[model samples]
Target: MKAELRGLPKDLAEVVAGHLVTAGMLIDDDPELAYRHAEAARRRAARLPVVREAAAETAYAAGHWDIALSEFRALRRMTGTDDFLPVMADCERALGRPQAAIKIAKEARHKQLEPALAIEMLIVEAGARADLGQQPEARRLLHQAILDLDDRRAAQLGLPAARLYYAYADVLEQTDRPADARQWFDRAARLDAEGDTDADERRDLLDGMSITFDDSDEDGSDEDGSDGSDSVEGESGEDESDEGESDEADEDEADEGESDESGSGQTRG
Candidate 1:
């Protein structure tokens, strides 16, 4: 077994060494540092497809979009495989070319990438469409993504599910369906909360819904007061009671806001 291992290729050995170095840098929370290691590995194993792919991924994570795109493009040309298409799309999106990203994502889907990855590409396409104000196309893509998730046997889990629901909520909100958006936001919040994934993001979504509810209440109250003032000549008991309740609610909201601020300060400290 030792002799057989020793006979293993030098190129593979260099690639493995690069992976280890890159992984170490990644573990240190330094993507830029890791990217250097990956680049070195890519240089040493230029003919190795896996090394190029790893280098591209690390470069992308390091926010070296130009380098990542170049590496991915090279890999695609060399292998003629769609495996790197989504990564290319991500690079394009980061570079503010959402339409290009959408196109690449579609090509990835055409190549029949994994269902999960395909769904992600669809989500990206939808977001790009939405950014371009193609609301109908965005909604259609989102609906298809939801249907795909529903048909899957595995229970939707983790960041992907959270993100999908969040995206759906955003689309609903953009379409002026606050009630439906709130439902989807609630679902996303619950999923993220349960998974312990970026609890602050989930909290923000819930807080936004709370603010929306407060705004709706205020608008309704103002409309009712205007109608009552026009119809009645004097201050009424019902109006007095409504004013008292509104004052209480405002005080409660103020207290909650203070508590939230205090909690955030403590967390930061």
Candidate 2:
């Protein structure tokens, strides 16, 4: 936090650092609280791009779509870059504004984006298409996006290719193409060792390892317990939980020796 805040004055840097510490600590376990801390940092250091980015990411994690979109817009204006367009567009989609999301995606400024960020925008745009009942278009866009990826670059970008496949598979299933869905889901699972998305669970459901059953069975429902064949929904609750990957494209970009650049007494990107 201190390194990222070095662009600010020393006094305000400490303040932002303290709030960022709180935000980072809570971001995974309690994202709402994390977002509060991030907003505090944003209030104190709204001029700094990193602070605004922190607030934007945490707000997105907490499902505060309106606030996230606002903060990302602020970040874009401050940085004069579209590095965050994918997340920003996704926030629009989350707010029940798919057309707005699509419009953001179609803007020409994003042509300058690095490959990973561009791929992320593709995923977000495909998701918006799905929201608008354009599954076929969504699947076609994602197919082109995957084909545009380089294998080595995909490996360096920390599993975006896997996520693209997952997004395509999800749209395929939604459009009632189960066999093709399974194929894409298989590709996603093979690439995603970290389980950053729910590809594994989706594959399992398609393969019928996951089952749904009535809970009111008198013969097997002993004291609300169950036999091995049919258990309650949460007995293995992985299906109910979201993977919360949100976006990872920036992580690939952020890994480019940021601390080393900050050590030279300036921020890069």
* Top-TM-score structure, candidate number: 2
lDDT per residue for candidate 2 within 13-131, as digits (tens), equals 88889998889899999999999999999888887787898898899999999999999999889888878888888999999999989998998344688766787888889999988
Off by over 4 Å in 1: 1-20, 24-28, 78-80, 151-158, 192-269
- Each candidate's TM vs. the true structure? 0.65, 0.74
Window of ten residues with lowest summed lDDT in model 1: 232-241
The lDDT for every candidate, in the order shown, is: 0.63, 0.76
**Residue 58 lDDT in candidate 2:** 93
Model 1, span 1-269: residue lDDT tens? 22322344867675567564665559348888788877776666666666677688788888999899999999888888776776788788788888899888767755868655665677777778887888878888886677766623324555667667777777876886655666676666676656644433433543432221223343355644542332211111122222335546645754453221222211110
* Per-candidate clashes, comma-separated: 0, 0
Which pairs of residues collide in candidate 2?
Answer: none
